[model samples]
Target: MPDARLVDSKASFASFSNVLDARLLRALADLGFARPTLVQSKAIPLALENRDILARARTGSGKTAAYCIPVVQKILNNTAASSSDSQSTRALILVPTRELSEQISAHLRGLVTYCDKEVTIANVSSGTTHHLQRTLLSDKPDIVVATPSKALALLQSKANTTLVIDEADLILSYGHDEDVRQIFSSGYLPKVYQSFLMSATMTDDVEQLKGLALRSPVILKLEEDEDEAANLTQYSVRCSEVDKFLLIYVILKLRLIKGKCIIFVNDVDRCYRLKLFLEQFSIKSCVLNSELPLNSRYHVVQEFNKGVYEYIIASDESIKKGEQDVESEEEDAAETKDDNCDQSKSRKRKHRHKGEGDKEYGVTRGVDFVDVSCVVNFDLPPSSRSYTHRVGRTARAGRSGMSLSFVVPEKEWGKNKVVGCVESTKKDEKISARIEAEQAARGSKIKEYKFDMKQVEAFRYRMEDALRAVTRSAVREARIKELKTEILNSDKLKAHFEDNPLDLEYLRHDKPLHPARVQSHMKHVPKYMLPKIAPVAGAEAPADSVAQDVGFVPFKKGGDRGRGRGRGRGRGGKKKSDPLKKFGR
Candidate 1:
């Protein structure tokens, strides 16, 4: 159950109509938001009163509107108080990703559409040019939704009266803690301003941010509906590394995947690789990663929503470009270069600097895809929290969804030693431990669902048959050619390679070459009909051996046929006892 104080059964947007301005109510009506979600009902009123709020709600439980409504209303109130000529940015909303920033900005724009006062809003993120953002900021929009790095950059010149950190848990996860800290501690903004921290999970990192950023905040914890869990059918498949993709192909071929699906990989390279592999099967799909331009990403999402594509392979790469650390070697080289040479190189670099698409902020968090019926974990998420977020992509807004995960069995090292497939390395082990601890701390559990072995075998067979249609050699060659062309054509890659020719050579030399598939001789043979290895001549026969009774000569031991030691007899003629005899006694 949710906190009793936060769950008002009679709570509606109209109930707060007296408190809210007429324009906002009209916007809500136009948007068809009849009732306030649990978080909205509780957090909205408290936020309207200008109280700092730390809130936890389910992923699709209207947390955005909960904070956005208050921030909009507050900005409008401040606007009404001041002169119409005054247009200072009053509210700042910081989200984790560009997709989320745009989403929030769009929603806020819709909400303030019918407002009497002209409430201008703008969104600033890494995808677009800083010049355009600066131009937009020069207008002094009443509210600005932005990513942390870009927001921090903008806040240096433009200060806000209110701050909202949506998906606060992701702020730390995406390594924006420092940017966030700078905004709060940097005297550029007001010493005292209203703040709101909201997320689906109340992580320790979020709590720490609350202590550092917010002044005495009101905590609102909303429970997830158990029925929502029931709405999603979770399942796991035990598979090998190679078989995972095969299984995916089989699932797709069989039409087992329902509606719009997202295949989530841990890194960008894997996402691209999987997309290419799916293409070999003639399965058309789009990719959503940081590598694509923001507009392209926006377009991909729109197309996906319109059923233009059945599947979109996404990656969990969330490191922003401004946050990337420059290599010391590059710095040293730059400092040692001649003035004229440096100027020439600078001009070349300026020419090469096309845009910010070179940055690798892959799609992990803050992406909401509509009608996502299923989420497939092409690779297992590093942590339980990641798993939660990935699955939360589906089963959103009270809709039923499904999540499927692939778990590889631990490999045996020796008779007694076993190693995990995913967490095989030390760093992976540490990360897995941290994820487990985080999940335990938050009381999150991953429910396991059983799958039938016959169905699995059938799928495997179908996958193997599908693989035969596309040769690994051909796919590898095609992929290599495509990559080489991409590298040669890309200004960023060409510039990077020019800086380090050895790296370019390495890329050419290390072009992906998948091993040729070998046909197994025993693949189609029945297990019972397979020939067994012949017994050694010196080995003792079985106790019920038909060969021994048919006058088969036994091998001599130590070249002494008459005085040989019998089976199970030691040199000292002692009989061995069971090791568990003591326990039995």
Candidate 2:
């Protein structure tokens, strides 16, 4: 059974004076936290009694404070009772990202400001000087907030009494489950200590992690209020691949976005590409990707919060890699290098692509941006969970916001179909099946998530109307010419265009319009234009239209089709050919 100090559902922060330390209560008051949030009220008391907690709450629900307050209270009480070394670590907080670790550290410092006892706190993570981390850990602080991998490396000497994993879902998603297990089984932590796992979304993976980490834990699942979703306006726009940038430009030009906005892309390359495209239109923006140095990433975030840039584009790439993996790769490369100088240079070229691997960290879960008014999904996220996290950046703390996603129709680049598979050969059957199964599972989960379908449809219609209006507006022609002149005159874009002229082809020619398209476009045309314009006659067809015709051709399956002709043809045939056998050979 949990401790009696656990607060009731209706209890406020002031109501917990009997259970909470006086100094902690004073600090909370100074921070202007009069009432406890649902998670904080329920989880704090149980945590103070050394109870394990598995909590599921929405983002921006004060979950950080829920865990931080109890941990601090426990540490203060323990230090007061015993005259132990003030620098010894008692609590360890593990987060998925360095940004989150910094945020938690800052919040902990705020909570400890009013305490009479000197409570020391330190943040250890990658991208910081190794010597600095060593110095910080040498004189162990009362609380240490760190990424899982970094914590495991620096925590060999301390036996912490409590462990808190914030954004537990993200830890599993980044394949850091093993790193987490290593921390628990590292023989450094106490066998019996309080553990807390908090997440915005709960899934089977989180359940599995709970089984592995907790014992007799109290589960607190706070249902998100309908008012939270009511405050957010979620919608999506359907556009072709080539027109996506144009659509975004139109939206921004029309002043559809309000206040500060965040644009999320699926990978780093697209993140930069979108930034450059926006720059061509004289739209100033900054980018947040893993390739930037840690200091630069921090500066970008700081500047973004200060309103230095209206749009900050971020990538969803996982940038944390194990130190062991990095060391082993370097050793193997050194061992395989030939004595010849040219051979060494050739080897370097061969491994050039590997340099793109996740070598630096980027923004992820638990980082908070203040007063964000909108979140734009330049690329659709691969899962519903990602979608939730991206949109959760806005409408925080009961404020109203909006989220817009661009949905592009899938297309084929060549003869092969764009069905998720690289090839349509029989050898890829298993791989294709696995891909389809995963996609189907994600699709089912998204449907069950229950977003507002009516609102989404209405938003789509509105976007269509906006697109037509922008396309037919008299200012569009002048705007396009002005944009072209700017792009050609700007030194940065001019050089880029010289190197990659194909990127500007879309702007060079006006796309031909079909009769149906013209009719739809006419709906948005001004009344003055309607009187001057007339539909094209059939005789006006260009003589070269027939020459431009390119009929569709069906994709032919690769490899031998007859039975016994291929290696994996018949039931008695040789073992099925491995799809990756070519790379090995």
Candidate 3:
């Protein structure tokens, strides 16, 4: 909105592109980068001049090259420095994920490759052989790209003259904010050196980053376009717990919003369970959690990067510990009892976490993915804040995204059991209080929907009927207009209609309008779902949809799904059914 060149190019971007150090430009050409993105064009020039910058931009915006080109330019172009005493790492680039670190390192190599200067890069992604690190650090690298844990450990082992933080917000939000500070605590880099914190969102922690990390800094924020949501279309479905996975299976089969998706959840175990469930559907998926070793986590991330895994399920705790919900004793006790009752059924429901809200789910928190398009919250988020974040994962980077949150009106937040009313978080409290006050002032009506569990499918069918009725009425109203117009023109509207008796309304959408009435199963069903059953009927999703899944793994092999196995755990070499297994039989 402000009057500022988003990119630094004053005239033609080509002018500067042509002027780039020959080696760097050659590398750019090799990488197929002809022109710079708006952020890159603006940020790179300043960085080349050693004028520290703070520019805001989204991922896939070419920010990496914007900074990388100039830094590599300095390293390769340094003619005054002598090789004899010219030691110590000249630049350090740190990132949140090992995959990201590897990605940056890969690009850095390309950019520096064209240079005649013999420069070495130290890559500190997870599971790097210790012997390799010892050799590189002692021999000395001109550049180092690493994750905080590995980089910090390496720097602790020795010292670095320079450092950089790629996803600064991740470090802060993930309970590793202190670790970042500690990485610099050794006073390795100069106090006045440059530090970059890159991310799409501008949370308060991002705005406050410089105070703790850098000196007076330059700040540039790139606003997402007004049409960012143009490509995404959203919908919410309510379903029974038993039908939830089936619904996901159906959607994946449809492949409507295809490509890789990062499934978010609040719990780690559920992430693995969902991963396994998705695998059962023959979908490629992987899981991310704190319990797994760094290498295993790295493997999952790498698999995703390589397109080997199209789905990743992870928790909010790993993203940012304090922001998510802790599994209280109540949930554990209930889960334990259910597990003891029947292990198979319990396993089916294991990762499902049917009615639990986003607080306990990972995708409900602030972390986001690169190019996801659809966010599906199998269960609703606990509050609007969680809901806002969950759905925000998709339709990103100047593209459109959609969110779908599942609600089953009959069940409480935990299950079919009538758990006491769920307590609202600070965010929900604010929303509820503000809504009530606004309603009282305007004398507007409100609807409440209560939760019910058993009749979920039945209620879903009822709401489908009502929605169909409304849609039919709308169609009839349109026909009435045409008939009246025909009468005025003295033309035969009925003759044309009879000739084409197809259902025009059904042709409007691909998926059928059968979301299973969410109102019928709510602990406090909102009036919108079923005026009588709604806990709060007038409430609308603040954004659009909520996100729920973030981890993926395989729970069953293909043979288990075969009809020949005849259900009941399937294919354990059972004898033909006698229709009776009694003692006499």
Candidate 4:
């Protein structure tokens, strides 16, 4: 490893010419990347020099390209210098989630498009058969991307290999500490090799990984520039439990928020509940959660980026549960027998079904969501860290974005038990306070946004009717139905879609999952029922006489001409004519 050094600040590279190969520079241009990001500009030069690096940069700061360019450049350089014809795995990239492994592999493929004949990569984190993975590894691909568990089988000493751990902080949180220990202690790492530990935050777990994986490494902590910081605007709305649903319905149905938006919830059940609720209004949205198959999850993200769906209801359930597990253990240690019993039941209810919600899946940390215009936190996260990552999905790559969070006031937490979440009821206020403090510490603020309830009141009864239909049983049925549909459409028709591109459009994820009663009239907003536009300030005020003369009619007509029991026919009890029903006559 190179001697340790600490650098505070530096200018970004003007271009990718000096540090990157011509082929890589061409690929960058083709991919529409104008210049190197701050982290990329600084780390690429040092990494090319074979220096170990511990770098911290926020999400969407181009950290993937920062390390990938150097790795590819070094591989190209090594192949040119060596005379051996035998191919071998020279670089190993470890990520926390399967989604991240796939994302990195895709990016690497893009970077190596012009040089695919010479460079090859494999992603072992993909849920393929073990036999197939072993076969792929037996061929000795140039680069291997995997989760720590997947890399366990491939941890053997190889000469001049490079080790890169992306999202190092999340690796341990995903419960891979033992796998990490085995890799580091197995004595399989090459004596002379470059190492990179990349993370978004400097957590204790990250420090622990650094000690095991790096020696005398240079530390680079890059802060977001002024432009980057100004791109994101954050707001929080205080509302009751039912109001959360009402506000989201109004915001989405009325197009108050535009462009692709990600609505985040705290658990798996909540994902389907919100999805089913939105479906009542004929608003289509896809669901992305850990319970779904890996292929389906990846495909959903792909479709979202391509604009096949405008809204996605996602769950950070696994990540939140991971944090909750540790906290619950601490509470159990200090609490009494009654408290322990209650927690035991809660655990059972949370984990009723295995191989589903209880996995290492995470949407907040590593998955890439492109061009998100807004993030709606249907349920406030359990911690400030979770909140940060949830909101980080938007305002990426210098594009403007907005984040709107629904905070349940303490007094209104459980007032409406039907739509209330236990976790949110117990911890929302505290978590919201911490989030505000954390943001303020970082020179940002989360302002309170108040929606005019009187104006939104017209939609409340409709929201109630919609909410009534989304019972627990209905949510469960929808969840199972969607899973079965995804397996059929995504897995069974995977080959067909590949061969026929146009057919992929018919494979929609946002199709309505209507196990509950769906009312056709609820689909459209009536003109008169629409919220009236507020009068602009400084405009001419209507005279008192004119204001008094105005009637309840929305249109300019004789108001009471059509409002009579007789209907201008007679005061006799006669059957009203139905022209459509008597069309045959």
Candidate 5:
């Protein structure tokens, strides 16, 4: 296993949050920071000294200020580094998600403005376009706040400078190994340009990056505060998958948590859906995900910071490599995100300058939603380190917080690990049973109620797959029927129609009509207008005159059967005959 520990710890400041530099001090005072968090006090001075640093600190532990202070101080000391020009980016701070970057940048903006300086910090993350990030990287800026892949592509462009991979180990072990290599290999980052690696877990790849990227880099360590530790109350709940969501909803209803909170899910789509469900009860929520546009993701975070949204659903493990159900680079390479194999000796190797092929990785250590009041897990993280990271979002920077991790029955993590965090919410007999029953009930309700989301998705894909091949014959009859059934089953879909059910007369049928016809039309148009188009054009027209003739006729021929049949038909006596063919009856 790689040594996931920060090797060097020399503390000039007692806390990572301390701002010792005069200008930084002024900014801090202006921003209302009373004192340094342990990590900040130590990491800041080391960073100011321009060392490749690997520091372990929890979220809200003032880690951002720990790194931010030094970078801002460096820009103040060295005018050449802070440039408005696009290609001259002095500092590149890579975070795990766009939301974190936006949140941090907002804080940075406040500090810089108070210090009477103007600086631009751009966020490059999934929710945003690669093109925009490339443009920024190509043009360069004072500093770039980005996710690994986005930054790596820019760095690979050889628009090189300082590289600071916050949560270096997280990125390397989980997400963006290939991209990290590109950044690591992207030409010379001179001594004047600094490298800083910050994370709570010091996995080996991060240490290697520190050694290879920094020149005589300094190291710092901060111990968690005793008071903060005492203040935090940790606990867990054991339940089935369904119960977990219900537990969370009940927790919310009970108002057991205070301040803004973050709930960590394993997937982005889940987060999005959860946010919607929470909103039904008048609770404002937001989601942070890779699929959201970068700026949109950024703004959602801004809203979180501004307290406009009460809860933000964050999937800490989603963006990482190897961890996702989908195969990623780390998994492809037969490694986990926190792989500590091939850890170098603690005796710092002087800037080996190994490139991408040398096994690149990053850490998710630095990206955290600070000051979170509570952390609830939809599922236990892949490992203990991930568990810590999820819980770390709360109880950070000397602040007190609590956590509630929901462990579903038969989930990979058993009862022991899930209940380990709680000092008081220990495993017991009836509570566990209650929790499990709740989970089953929630799931049963969801399943029994006829909401088949996956089917809906599959149907969508099926239509896309089949629709493009619309042949001369009808392409949608089966699909349409299937979709109609699905719509009838879906609460979301049904609610949509009930609100606007084509308002057609057929929709007004006495039997709470399925309005299958109206639904089919409403599927294509407004509910009220469904009847106007659904009856098949000319279906109501006079019956084909030839229909009065022989029961059947060849499709292409028979010369307008209605016309033929009408002329052939005699009053009352003879068998129906066709006018065109003199058939004996």
Candidate 6:
């Protein structure tokens, strides 16, 4: 029950020299890590002493490196001390998702960059064939990363001396509790191995896991300081179903938002639907969900971090709902049945295989998206916890970020049945209120953003045009089509992509899924449609800069070529009366 505040804030990497190996120190320095994070400073020392640990820290707070450094250090020390061939799996790190397994493995590789020959690692949840994975496990790598179900079948656990369950709060919700029980209860490890359970939040499920895995462990609850919490600005805007599309189109197409953004939806169909709608406007964004191959999803995140893509339309469908959620959804279905029987059946059919999506795929929590400038909740999440994880993707590592959520009024739910999500939308006001209270309890404020929707009414036609093009048939087709394409890219053509670097660059995830009609005019905003307050290219600030207070959207007037350039003259050199030059007067 130790509060993390008592931990020494001035603890430095040099202080760990007594406990850490020299090679590990050199590797950390090579990675440009000057000082240890708070969790790292506290956990590393205890972990080095072989103490079982249950630690909680915020996301992107270097939790991965905290445990990894100690584990790698221990293995390095053991290899030096042992005389014989000590070629056995010494550590097992379990995660909730394949993406996280790969992430941890990559970080481990960096930590062992200078000592690669001495330590080896494998990821059993990498979507490779079990035969291939079994073959890989036969080498007895020093470290193994996997999800619980994957490890239950392939792991020979007698030789392992250390176990780590990353994202401990999520593992049980993903329906891995049984697999975990089977692994630990059925003689999966040595009797005296050290254990580490690391997570961003602690819940009853995590408390239960402490009993199953850890001994009398050191519990470290690291609370975020005020300065770190202040880095995020949360905003909520209430809009109709159609207005959500119009506002997002205006926000993105007008270049109001700066840097990379992640748009989160509640359902898989909504993910493809928003992507296809944006595609009509030629906005380049990749889709991430459980339906795609794990390798392709990892590649999408890699490309985004490398600045290859600016936006990612993701659905947190992989986040398993709790028992309360199940009961509420059943109630919502019954309510919908009386109002519209046919729509309820359609919704039921759409979700007949809801649980069939990859249980081991998660994006809202464990999967890190680097330098995310903003998070747009295209659909309100079902719970306050889900809301926290969605916004947590940004405002990380002391970086300032914004989260803008769209809340549908109770009166406006299911107005346009096409883009409507009945289950998640029906209680938008309630969910938003809960979210506000939760944030307020944490000393954070979620301001009600007052956006003048009338100013951007001009974009409604374009939104409508694009929305019509993305029909139900079109969305279904795009989903099937993208899955096939990603399968080819991830599995069938694995060797081909490995050999051809240029071809890999050309094989983009954001390519247009164009089963719908391509409205070329929608791609470019017309000059006459510019809002009066938006800044024109090469123009000074407008007199009414009140809109600047909105903060999330910096309205810039782009896409105009001749305005305020060359004396507003056309190609024929005729001095034309430029309407944009008169804007904001």
Identify the superior model by TM-score, candidate 3 or candidate 5: 3
TM-score of each predicted structure versus truth: 0.69, 0.65, 0.58, 0.87, 0.56, 0.87
Winner by TM-score:
6
Per-residue lDDT tens digits for candidate 3, residues 68-100, read 776676665553455566566778887766546
Worst lDDT 10-window in candidate 5 = 508-517
Which scores better on lDDT, 1 or 3? 1
Report how far residue 209 has shifted in candidate 4, in Å: 0.7
**Greater-lDDT candidate between 1 and 4:** 4
Q: lDDT per prediction? A: 0.61, 0.59, 0.48, 0.76, 0.48, 0.80
Query: Which stretches in model 1 have alpha-carbon errors above 4 Å?
Result: 1-9, 157-159, 318-362, 412-585
Q: Regarding TM-score, does 2 or 4 come out ahead? A: 4
Candidate 6 stretches with Cα past 4 Å from truth are 1-12, 318-343, 354-356, 500-503, 534-585
For model 6, residues 1-585, the per-residue Cα lDDT tens digits are: 223334454666665676777788888888767788888988987887889999999887889988999899889889988998858999999998888998889889988988999999999999789999999999999999999999999967599999999999888888788999899889988888999999988788899999999999999999788867866777788889888998899888876667789999877888889999999999989999888888789989989988899999998763244512444567667776466664666567657966656778888877778878779999888877788888999877767677889999988877786665546677889779888987999898886665655667777877887898889999999999999999888873357776776676776889888988987878777666766544546877756543443322223233333322112222243543322221111
Q: What ordering of candidates by TM-score runs from best to worst?
A: 6, 4, 1, 2, 3, 5
Which is better, 1 or 3, measured by TM-score?
Answer: 1
TM-score of 6: 0.87
**Local lDDT at 562 for model 6:** 33
- Model 2 score (lDDT): 0.59
Please report, as a residue range, the 10-residue window in candidate 4 with the lowest summed lDDT. Answer: 576-585
Between prediction 5 and prediction 6, which has the larger lDDT?
6
Ten contiguous residues minimizing lDDT sum, candidate 1: 576-585
Candidate 2, residues 433-466: lDDT per residue as tens digits? 3323543453311111122233223234434433
Best of the two (3, 6) by lDDT? 6
Tell me how many clashing residue pairs each candidate has. 1, 0, 67, 0, 53, 0
Predicted candidate 1, C-alpha RMSD? 17.9
Deviation of model 6 at 566, angstroms = 37
Q: Candidate 4 deviates by what RMSD?
A: 12.2
